[model samples]
Target: MASQTDDTDRITVRLAGREHRDWTTYRIDSHLITPADAWQVTLGIPADALPDTVKPWAAVDVCLGQDVVLTGRIDRIEREVAKGTNALAISGRDGAAVMVDCSAPIFTRRKATLTEVVDLAVRPLGVSQVRVEATGAKEKVEIEPGMTAWDALAQACEANGCWAWFEPDGTLVVGGPDYTAAPVATLVMRQSGQGNNVLSLAVTEDVSGRYSEVTVLGQAHGTETTDGQHNIKHQETDADVPGYRPLILVAGDCDGAAEAKRRAQKTLMDSRLEGFTITARVRGHRVSESGKPWTPGQRIQVVSEPHGLDATYFLMARTFLGGRDKGSITELTLKEDGVWLPELAKISGGKGKGKAASAGKVVELS
Candidate 1:
C-alpha cells in the first residue's frame, strides 16, 4: 500500500524480483504526490555520471498494491511530449509484458561501455585513419567499459578530423570537403599577354583519378612582335569576347608532354573566342604554317565570324615538339576592334610589362 506523510514526501511499495529472490523497498520523493496516482519522476544526474556496470537491456521490477507490474530496460530518458518534463520509458525483454507511461520516476541506467563508445565514434570517418587523444580524464580508458553510441560517435570525430553537429531542427550534420588540403592533381595554364594575343599554356600533374578532360577559358587578341633581325610574329584575334566563359580541353592520355597540346587545343576551341577571328601559334608554329613548304606545322589564321580554334594543328605539333619547353603555345588578344593588320609590336608593350604579363600565364586550374 502507498500513503503520503508530508507535502514533500510519500511512501510507495516497490518490489524488485529476480529468479531466486523477491524484495520490497519504500520509495520517497522530495514533493508530496497528489492522489498518489500520476506524477513524474526525474533522476537529476549527468549522462556521464552513471556507473559502467549497467547492461543495455537490464530490467527491474515494480509492484503496486495487489496489482503487480513489471518495467524493463531503460531505452533513453526523454522530455515529456506534452508538459516538456523529463521522463523515461522502460522497455521489456523478449516475450515479457511491461507497463507504459508509469507515473513514478525509476532508477537511471549506467553509461555505455568503452568498447561501445569507440565503435560509434569510428563508424562515420571511414577506414582511412585512426587517431586517439593522448591527454584527458576520459582518455584514460583505452576502451570505455560502458558508453553510449552517441558518446562513441563524438569521440571518433575528434580523433579522425571528422565531426557531427546538430542543426536548428536537431538534424545531424556530417562530412564536408577540406579545401585547405591540396588536391591530388593540378592543371596549370599560362598566358603571356592581353586580349587575342594572350598566350595560353597548360600542364597537368598528380592526377590519379579518372577525369575526362580539363579546360581553360579567357580572351584572345592579335598582336605582332619582332626579333633583332626584324621577323614578325602574329597572334590570336577576336572581335566580340565575353567578360567570362568556360573553355574545355579534352584528350586521350593525361601523361607526358604530348597531352599538353591536346589540352591547349580544347581550351582554344571551347573559349569565348570560339566564333571570333583568331590565329593560334601552337607548339612554336602558327596554324597557317602547317602543310606549307616552309612551315613544319600548320599555321592557319582565319577571320570567320565564329570559327573555333583548330585543335588538331596545335595538339599534333605539340606532341612532336616534346618536353616542358616554354615556346609551346602563344595567343594574343585584341584591344580595339578593327581589320587585321601586321605590325612589329614589342612583346613587352603592356602596362604591366614583363612581370604582370607572366602572372596568369601558367595558372594550375585543378
Candidate 2:
C-alpha cells in the first residue's frame, strides 16, 4: 500500500559484499552537520530473518530516488520479537565519522592561516573529497595537544567564523550560511483542517544572555616613555538592544586596540544571534517554493500569531522521518539572519603550548 511518493522513495542496503533490495524502510533522520548527520532504518522481518552475513561494521548506502543521501558504515543493529511479529533496526553515521574518530598531530612554524591549518589537519586523514570555501587571510593559530582531527577542524572553523559539514555524498563542505536567497516557504498556523500544512511549531526568545555593551581587554605591550610602562589598549562595542547588559572579554593574544575591537564586535554579534530560535515540525517532504526536499542552511519564512512571531530564518538543523503511519515529517531548528559568521574573524583565548603565557595573547591574532 505505498503511495506515489512512497513508491518513488527508496533505500538501498549493502552488506557483506551483497546488495539487499526492496527492504522495508521505516524512518530516516539525517542532517548536514557533524554528529547529527545520521540515519536509521527499520524493517519488518520474521524471527531469525537476519542472516549471519548481515553484521555490524558493514557498509551502508541510503538513497532517495537516484540520489545517494548517505554513505556510511553500519554501527549497530537491534532486533525485536513480540506478539507474533518481529522487526530489525539498523543505524549508522556518515563519512564524517572517520574525521571525528581519527587522531592527528599538526604543527606550524610561528603561524599559519586558517585555511592552511585546516588543510594540514585533514590531509592526514585522506578524505576522498572536499568542498572547502575560500577562507582569505592568514592568522596566528595553535592546535592544542592530543587533539583529534575533528577538534582541530572545529577550532579552525570557529576561528574563521565558518562552519563545516559532510555532504550526503561524503564530501566535506566548509562555508558560511547564506541569507541572500528568498525563503523557500511560508508557514502559517491555522484552524483544524484549514490552510495550514504544519504539524507542530514552537518559538523561543531569551534576553537573559543578551548584552548591550561589549568590552574586549587586550594585551598590554611596551608603553610610552612618559609612564615607562607596558602599553595596554581596550576596545568597547555596543549592541542594538535597550538597557545596559555588559559583557567583558580578555584577549591575552590580542596585539592592539583594533584587534580587540574586532573581537568585541564579533562576540556581541554571536550572542545576539543565539538569543532566539524556532523549532517546527512540518508535513510533506518537498518545499512548495523549490519543489525540493528541505535541507539545512535553507531560508524559510515563519509566521505564528500566538507566539507573536513573523520573521524569516535560516534552517540550522533538520531531521526527516518517513514511515507507514505518519508518512513523512520534517523537524527543523532555525536561527535568525544575523547569526551567520561567514567572513568575520573569530575569538579564541585559552592556555596553549610552546609560547610563554604572554606569547599566546588572550585574543587570537588575525
- Predictions: Cα RMSD each: 32.5, 9.4
lDDT of 2 at 197: 65
What ranges in model 2 sit over 4 Å off?
Answer: 1-6, 9-36, 51-54, 80-86, 105-112, 190-194, 220-242, 342-366
lDDT (tens digit, per residue) of candidate 2 on 188-304: 775444666688888776778777777776674444543222344454443345588878787776656666665776776666656767789887666767657677877776666
Q: Quantify all predictions' global Cα lDDT against the true fold.
A: 0.25, 0.63
Q: Report the poorest 10 consecutive residues by lDDT, candidate 2.
A: 354-363
Q: Which candidate should be chosen as best, given TM-score against the real structure?
A: 2
Cα TM-score per model: 0.14, 0.77
lDDT of 1 at 85: 35
Q: What local lDDT score does residue 254 receive in model 2, on the 0 to 100 scale?
A: 62
Badly placed stretches (over 4 Å) of model 1 are 1-142, 148-150, 176-366
